[model samples]
Structures are given as C-alpha cells and as structure tokens.
Target: MPSLEVIDEHIVLDILSSTVRLVGSLLPNNIEVVLHDLRNPECSVVEISSPSITGRKKGDSVISGARRDPAFANLMEFSSEPITYVLNYETQDNAGNPLRSSSAIYRNAQGMPFAALCINADYQQIDKAIALIQQLTASELNPTFKKEQQVIISEPTPDNIDALLQEIIDIAMEQNPGSNRPAIKKANLVAVQRMQERGIFIIKGGVEKAAKALGVSRYTVYNYLDELKAQNEGE
Candidate 1:
C-alpha cells in the first residue's frame, strides 16, 4: 500500500497542476505548488512547477537547497490558514536580481498544512498600462488593495479525546457553578453511576486506576462503590 503522505501529495499536486494550467492560460505567467510537511520536521513532499519558475522540478525538495528563504520558512510556520503576501523589495530573481512576486498558503483538514502557491506577476508592464489608461479617464485612480495575512494557532487540549469520561463532570460543574457544593463529590457520583451501568467496576484494578486517572481520591472511589451496592440492594 502507498503511504498516506504519498497519496495526499499526489492529490494536492494534481489539483495545483489543474489550477495552474487553467489560470496560466488566461494570464501571462504560470503558477506552482510547493509542498512541505510542517508536522514532520520540514520534509518536502512534492513540487509542481511552471515554465516561468526556473530550476525547480517535480519531486525535488526545494528546501534542501534554498533553506535560507524566509518565505519558505514562513509558509511552513503559517500553513494553518490561507496567507497571501507580496515578496519583499530585496527579494531576488532566478538571475539573482531583485524581482516582485506574490505567494499564498493552504492548509488541510487535520490542521496540518504544507502547500504554497506563488506567482510572479508582470508588474512593470501592468503598471505602465494602468497608468496610460488613467491618463485617458478623468476619474482618480485607486491604489491596489492587498489582503492582510492572518495566523491561526491551534493548541492540542485534553477535550480532543473522543471517549472523554471526565468531560461529563466538567460540563455538570459548568452548568451549576454557584451551587456551593463540592464538585469532586458530584464527579464521584457521576463516575459511580456510569460504572454501575457499564459494569466496569467489576473488573479488577479498574476502579482504582480510573479514580487515579480522573484525579479523584481512592476513598472517593470506594465510597462510590459502596453507594452503588446500597442502591442495588434497595432495588
């Protein structure tokens, strides 16, 4: 079976290639996708190139050679959301001379992102043409609007667990915060009730371990067991 990374890379490459071809046909320059794994210590997964961007080939890890580029580093760090930016004035061209460019980042569903799309617009000619058109019209020309880049950080929390037994206690306490009652007692009661329903307390070492895991005292666990026994006897 092919690795998940390989499959994901192929899918992303195909999508990026189709987009590049579709958009490049309408525009003068080409677009490209550069993939890097942010979760796995900056491993290059794939690279889809355009005719305009020289030297970069598919499957060639660009970072291995050009690790010093801040744009690439920033793309890796800020891959959680789409970010658009204009290259700094001092940024160099393929010929090592200064050139202007734009770039964007895209993230995946798991909040792990590693793709960037960059385009080098022909600004000199476009600016000149726009200026000429401005002379013909009496209306004032408005400056081009650039979108601001936003960074979203997602931290892993305990609530991310699927079968979070402690979540019920947390929610119950939240729903009744000012009751002046002990939250630990409420949690203990809830845990005991659940254990009775599930018959998990019958298993050896389960009750003690569960109590320790849930940050409750052993005495509380024994008390819950006793209450459960009393309730069963009454029933």
Candidate 2:
C-alpha cells in the first residue's frame, strides 16, 4: 500500500477548485465560494461558486470582499501556523446587502501564502423572513417578541492597495490626534503602533507610506516598531 504523499501546489489548487464547486452546490444558494491565487493579485480568483451572492467570477482580484479586511489580511502575521483563517466577519455585497464572510489562507512548503479560500453568505432574505414571522406571531401586549434588528457592516473594500494603506493611516491618525510638538511625537508613536498591530507594515512599501502619512522618516518608523517590541516584551 502507498502512503499519502505531499502533492504539488497546482494539484492542491485543482483539488480545492473541485471542492469549491462541490461545497457551493451542497450549500444554500445564497452562499458563495471562491478560490484565489495569491501570487497573482491582479487576477487572483481562479475558481468561483454560487457567483450570484457576490457577483465574483474567475480572473477577479482578491482586493475586494474579505481580502481587504484588516483582520483577515493580518491573520498570518499573528499566527505561527502555516495555515491561518478568519471567520464570521460582517461584510456587504455590491448592492449593499449584508453578508457573513470568512476566509482561509493556504501556504506552500516555504510558508508563503499561495492561495486563499473565501466564503460569503448573504442572509438578508432570511432576516426578512424571520422578521415577518415574528410580526405575525407576536402578541399585541407582549413587547418582548418585537426585537430590534441589529446588523454590523464592515467597511467597504478600497479600490487599490494604495487606497487601503491611506485608509489605515487616516484611521490611525484619527485615533491618535496631537497639536503640540511633544504631543505630536507621542501621537506618531501611537499611530505607528496601531498600524503595526493592524499589519500595515507587512506589505511592500507599507513603511514608506506610513512614514509619509505620519510626517516622519522611514527610519523613525523602524525605531517606533523596535520600541513597541521592547514595550511588549517588558509587559
């Protein structure tokens, strides 16, 4: 008998492609499945199932949907494992309908991400149906049956990588505002710390973009990161 062998990346991707189709067919039609080739960001999507949910097709970029999510992008950096994932995040479709999303990153033997699997499930219709049922069955005197609906919507995907970086920098600056010189230095340090936590510095040119945004040199950003590491270790 032959033992299981480590297959090549292409073969693994092919298997995932079939899995995508099978999973999509078995799941509710509102759920979408997609396989992304991380090496080719420009045309990352290699397979898609139930495209109606998000309208994603083959040869599409992963810049949209869960890929732009900061938590999803930074999962690999926070985890030492070769496989990492983020789940049950809130997102929206192109038409602004609410969706529950999840994503997993697949790495090659070298621990570099080569592909990603993403799922988006639209439950807007289901919510509407539930609301109607509640309205119909609820007693006129009992107020407890009429529950308020709360939906959490994630930020929309940026148009490009530059836009994503800019948004991250803007958010960091907003969180650490300053006016005076000393306050500004502390603000910059806090801003860099926030950016690093969100994995902004992981991408190429991220340090340069952040430095420009924070009005500091690239070396200053590096110093900030080192200081942050030291502080974390001290704690």
Candidate 3:
C-alpha cells in the first residue's frame, strides 16, 4: 500500500502567510483579513491587515469574535472539516452596518485544524448604490400623475383682409347712415381710416375693393389714406 501525502506544519503556515499577503494586496481597502491561531483561543488574532476595517488589531481574541460574529462563529465545532468557506454571509459592525464575509479553516498534517482565515468585506456602499438605482427605476412618486395640465389656446392673429373689410363696411352702413352728406362723408372717411389700420389697404386689390364698397373712385380711397397718415404723423 502507498503512503498518503501529508501537509507539513512549516509549509502550511508559510502557505497561509503568502496567501494572506496576496489576498491583502488584491482586495480593496474596505476589506479586512484576519489570521487566527486556534491554538490560542484567548488571543486568537495572530495577525490582521486593514485593522481600520474590522476595528481589531493583533492579539484580539477569536473567542470574542466567534461569540458575536454570525459568519465566523462556531469555529470550535469545525475542527474536522477539511476546508470550509461561506459566501454572502451577513455580518454587522458595532454600529450595526452590514457586511459580506467569507471564512475558512485549514488543518495541519495531524488532521487537526489549528488556524482560521476570515475576510470581511463592507458592502454598505454597494447597498446604497443599489438603493439609489431602485429609486431611479421603481419609484412611486410621480409629479405627472396627480397634477392637471391646462393649455390656454389663444385666438389667431392676422385676419383675412378682404373678409374683414366687408364686415367693417357692413357695420358702418348699419350704424345709421344719418341725414346729411357731411355726416355720410364723415362716416365713409372714418370707415376708410379703420380699414387702413386693419391692414386692408396694403393688400392687392384692397383700394379697388374699398372704392366699390364706398361707391367712390380709387382716388378718393388714396386721399382718405393720405389724410389718416398725416393725422398719425402729427400725433
């Protein structure tokens, strides 16, 4: 029968130390790594990197950590397991902020586990980012939902010159074409001045149409327009 390969004591510790350095270099600043000496439970934290993250320094007891750490607790009962690792395990700090962590136990040549390596990664920032994304995508408060939109469409500008000119002539005639020629001539001059302001005289055929509407020659419309311009310039 062939003898089985066994891990040496010095080799195991050296391998673990190198692993600690490699993982420590690769992980971000928010992550922490702690090496526990199970043989010294009362002071199990033999080494720690990023002490600011876990709030622990070297020589801190593993017994205290296992007592409070949900992910790292129960280490004493895991002596027989060749290798154990947990993922996405919930861990909370002193202020109750959450973390994601993984831990493992490695045994020596004697088939007795003597050490533990744990990694605690703070995921509070990630959780905050996820919450913001949720707010952007699945939010319930919508300004467009409860408020009403009102549109006040105004009346159009630029009336049709011919149609408006006819209407104005009709209105002036109906306003009592009273007894004398002076009164009738006054009415006609007033009507022509109003049409010029209404932009009618500036259009093609407007002077001819106004002459016919007043039963006068186009020259008379021109005279009325000149008089209105002189009055405006004097003002």
Give the candidate number with the greatest lDDT.
2
- Residue-wise C-alpha lDDT for candidate 1, range 1-235, written one tens digit per residue: 2223334644765687577667766665423333433333223334444434334444433322221245543554433344434363223333433335555555554434545566543344456568666654533443453334445332112221123345444654565454454755665576556443333343234466557656777787787778877877999
lDDT of all predictions: 0.47, 0.71, 0.63
Evaluate residue 54 in candidate 1 and report its C-alpha lDDT on the 0 to 100 scale: 35
By TM-score, the best candidate is 2
User: What C-alpha lDDT, on a 0 to 100 scale, does residue 36 get in candidate 3?
Assistant: 77
Q: What are the runs in model 3 whose C-alpha is more than 4 Å off? A: 1-5, 64-67, 109-111, 125-235
Q: For candidate 2, lDDT tens digit of each residue in 57-165? A: 7876565543335655675453335578889987656555667888888776666777788889888768878977777678455756656766755454555555655
- True-structure lDDT of candidate 2: 0.71
- Across 1-235, the per-residue lDDT of candidate 3 in tens digits comes to 1111365555665677677778888777778888877665545677677666656666765532311354454443434456656665777553445666778866554445577888878776567678766665554565343323434342222124445556667667667487588777777878886665443443346688889878899998899878877987999
lDDT of 1: 0.47
Q: Could you tell which candidate, 1 or 3, scores higher by lDDT? A: 3
Q: Native-vs-model 3 lDDT? A: 0.63
lDDT-wise, the better of 2 and 3 is: 2
* TM value for model 2: 0.57
